[model samples]
Each structure stands twice: as structure tokens, then as C-alpha cells.
Target: MTKPRVLLADDHRMVAEGLKSLLAEEFELAGIVEDGLALVKAARELNPDAIVADISMPNLTGIDALVQLKRDNPQVRVVFLTMHRNPAYARRALQIGALGFVLKHSAPAELVLAVRAALEGRTFIAPDLAAEVFRTPAKKEAGPAEALTSRQREILQLLAQGHSAKQIGAALNLSARTVEDHKYRLMETLGIENNAELIHFAIKHGLAP
Candidate 1:
């Protein structure tokens, strides 16, 4: 029988390698990428059966990448593996269509199982978080970060990561002036007065890795 094909995405070399090893016996490793942007690209090119990804990755976050990927291919199956133990994060991830949310600390024992579950069209939340994630109200008011457009969120993350307007423009294919305009507009939308506060908001809201 053929093993299910899986793509791995994590910025940490050691962690990615360990996951690769962990999943190798039961799944075919379609590809591995170190950033969310690459994860999006690889998933498009490779069309793996499932993706194991980190939520906090460079260039684009796993959630943001998923939003974009889903627009193009809604059937894509993603299982997030991350250090974030927050129930809110898991709730948002599942709400956004992730099939699994496994924490990094529990990955050795749960990741393969999560992948298997996702491949079988089942949802899997880390046992430690499942109750809390499900108990949380699904219709809570949107947070400041949640109100931002996906592009704005991307720009916010890049800004918090210390990328200048020019660099961000280069990465996002916008003009530097446009990037600056976006910064100001997003700051205003979030009621932030300066770059420092913007960064603080981004970090506080899990928009920045």
C-alpha cells in the first residue's frame, strides 16, 4: 500500500528534521519548507495529500498562508504543529479549516496520529486543548488583529519583524510609499500611534512570530 504524501513546514531546522524522521515511517515526505511562503508554493507545486506546518513562520504565517491557499484550492488539508498552547489559536485554526492542531511538545506522540486523522478527513485537536477549544464561544467579538485585512495582517507581521517599508514593499511587490501608506492606515485602524505600539499590538495579538 502507498503511504500518504505529506509536506512539512517549520522554520526551525532541528524541529523540522525531527518531524521528518517521525513521519517518514508512516508517510511519504513530499517536501519540506522552512517558511510559510515556501509552504504555500510547495503545496501548490507538489499537491501533497496533507501539510504539517508551523503557525509562526517567516514571510507568511501558516494561518495567512492557509487563507490564501484555501482560496486557490479549498480541498487542501493542513495540520498545524506549533509551540503555541493557547486555546484561542487552536480555535481560530480550526475555524479557518485546519484539520488538526497539535502542539510541538506533544508532537512526537501525536503528530503522526494528527496527520492520519487529517488524511482520513477527521478533525484532531491536541487532547490537552480540545475541551477548552470547544468550550470557547464561537461568536465572540472580533479582536483588533482579526479586523485587519489579510494583506494588512501580513504587513503588520512584517513590520513587527523589523522589516522596513522598502523591504516589505519588495517582499509584497508593493511600492515603498504604498507600504508606508498601509502601515499608517493599519496603525490608525488599530488605534496605534507609532511603530513601537504597532509592533506591540502585533506581538500581543499573535500576528507576529
Candidate 2:
């Protein structure tokens, strides 16, 4: 049997390394990309059978990248590997067509199962979070950060991670003024007064780890 081709997207080098080692025996690594923007480019270029990505990534979030990838290649399966245990995140990933959602702290064995399940057209969630992830919330309330557009959410996460507007602009290929304008708009939309408040809001809403 032919091994599936896999692409990996994660900003943390260590995490990527660990995943590469874990999957080495089971899959063919098409390529590795460090950020979501690069992930998009790599997906387009490599045409992998599956992708494992982090949710919080520089330039673009993994979810946003997956949206683009799906647009271009709807058949490719994707499994999200994230540190966040938040059910809301899992809900969003599934809504956006992710095949699996695996928590970073879960046993490495779970990842293999997730990959196999995804390839078989089955959905997989970390065992510990399966109940919460599948349960319907009492109310479909959008979190403050969730209300923002994908770009805004990406910028917000970067800001919360202590990147300045200029740095964020460079990373996202936007102007510094544009990045600042986004910050201003996010503040107004979220009823935040400053960067500190914005960071607080991001953490509260799972936009930042």
C-alpha cells in the first residue's frame, strides 16, 4: 500500500519536529511550513493527501489557511494539532471542515489514530475533549474575538503575542499604518481601551494561548 502524503504547518519548531518524528513511520512528509501563509503556498505547491496544522500561526491562522486550501482542493483532509483544549476551538475547527482535532498534550498514539480516521473519512477529536466537542452549546454566542474577521483575528493573536504593529505588518505583508488601523478597529469593536485590554480579551476568547 502507498503511504499518504502529509504536509505540516506549525510555527513552533519543536512541535513540528516532534510531529515529523511521530509520523515518519506512517506517512510521507511532503513538506513543512512554519506559518499559515507558507502553509497555504505549500499546500498549493505540494498537493499533499493530508495536513496537520496548528491553529495559532503567524501571518495567518491555520483555520484561515485551511479555508483557502479547501477552496483550492476540497478533497484534501486536514487534522488540527493545537495546544488549546477549548471546546469552542474544536467546534470551530469542525465547522470549518477539519477532519480531526487533536490536543497537543494528548498521547502521541492518538495522532496516528486521528490520521487514519481522517483518511478513512471519519472525524476524530481528542478522547478527553470528545464529549465537549460534540455537545451543542446552550446558546450560540460568538465570543468577542470570534466576531472579528479572519485577518483581524490573526492580527489580534499577533498583538497578544507581543508583536508591535510594524512587526505584525511586516509579517502579514500589510503596512504599519494598516496594522495600526486594524488594532484601532478591533479595540472599538471589542470595547477595549488599549493593548492591555485587547490582550486580555484575546486570552479570554482563546485567540491567544
Candidate 3:
């Protein structure tokens, strides 16, 4: 029998290496990407049966990347592997169509189980987070920060990470002027006036760590 195709996305080189080993036996490795933007591109090209991604990633977050991917391939399964224990993140992942939300600290077996559940069209949350995922009610309205477009949020994260417009542009394949424009618009939307304030806003709103 053919193994399921899996795409892996995470910024940490060591973590990606570890997952590659663990997943090798159970799934056909489609490709591995270091950031969310690359993950989206790779997923589109590879058309994997499922994706395992980290929530906090550069260029675009896993959730945002998955959002874009779902627009074109809604049947693709995604299981988020995140370091965040925050129930809010888990709830958001599920709400955005992720079938699994496993914590980074979870046992390796749990990730395998999560992947299997996702492939079978079932939902899986880390045992510790399962209760919280269910206990949380659906959000009726988008949060102020959530109102930002995916591109805006990506630029905001780079800004919060202290990347200059030129660096951010190079990273995302946008022009420096475009990066600057996005920064300005994000700042205006959030009512922030400067880089310091923008960084603070991103942290407070969980746009960046």
C-alpha cells in the first residue's frame, strides 16, 4: 500500500530534522519548508495529502498559510505542531479548518496519532488541550488584530522581529518600498505611530512572539 504524502513546515532546523525521522516510516515525505510562505508554495506544488506545520513561523504564520492553501485546496488536511500551550491558539487552528492541534512537547507517538486522525477525517488535539478546545466557544467577531490581512500580518511579524524594510522585502520577495508601505498601513490600522509601538502591538496581540 502507498503511504500518505506529508509536507513538514517548521522554522527550527533541528525540529524539522527530528520530525523527518519520525515521519519517514509512516508517510511519504513530500517536502520540507522552513517558513510558512515556502510551505504554501511547496504544498501547492506537491499537493500533499496532509501538512504538519508550526503555528509561529516567519514570512507567514502556519494558520495564515493554511488559510491561503485552503482557498485552493480545501480538502487538504493540516495538523498544527506548536510550542504554544495557549488554548486560544488551538481553538483558532480548529476554527480555521485544521484537523489536528498537537503541542510541541507532546510525545512523538501523539503526533503520529494526530496525523492518522487527520488523514481519516477526524479531529485531534493534544490530550492536555482537548478539554480546552471543546470548552472554548466559537468567536462571533474578528479581533482587532485579526482584522489585518494575511500580507499585512506577515509584514507586521517581520517588523516586530526587528527586520528592516529591505530585509523583510528580501525575505518575502517584495520590494523594499512595498514592505515600507505595508508597515505604514499596519501601523495606521493599529493606531501605532512607530516601530517600537508596532512591535509592542504585535506581541500584545500574538502576531509575533
Q: For candidate 2, report its TM-score.
A: 0.84
TM-scores of the candidates in the order shown? 0.94, 0.84, 0.90
| Root-mean-square deviation of Cα positions for candidate 3 versus the true structure, in angstroms | 2.1
| Candidate models: Cα lDDT each | 0.90, 0.88, 0.89
Candidate 1, superposed: residue stretches over 4 Å from native: 138-140
The C-alpha stretches of model 2 lying farther than 4 A from their native spots are: none
TM-score of 3: 0.90
Residue clash pairs of candidate 2:
none
Question: Which ten contiguous residues of candidate 2 have the minimum total lDDT?
Answer: 139-148
lDDT of 2 by residue, 1-209 (tens): 88999999999898898899999999999998998879998999998888999998876678778877888888879999998888988888899899999999999999999999998989999999999988878986666656788789888888998998899998888999999999999989988898889888877776675
Residue-level lDDT of model 1, residues 1-209, one tens digit each, is: 99999999999989889989999899999988998778888999999999999999988899999998898788889999999998888988988899999998884878888999999999999998899999947576777777899899889999999999999999888999999999999978988898899989988988888
lDDT of 3 by residue, 108-178 (tens): 99999999999999999999888877895765787778789878988888888888899989988899999
RMSD of each: 1.5, 2.4, 2.1
Model 1 weakest 10-residue run by lDDT: 136-145
Of the candidates shown, which would achieve the greatest TM-score relative to the real structure?
1
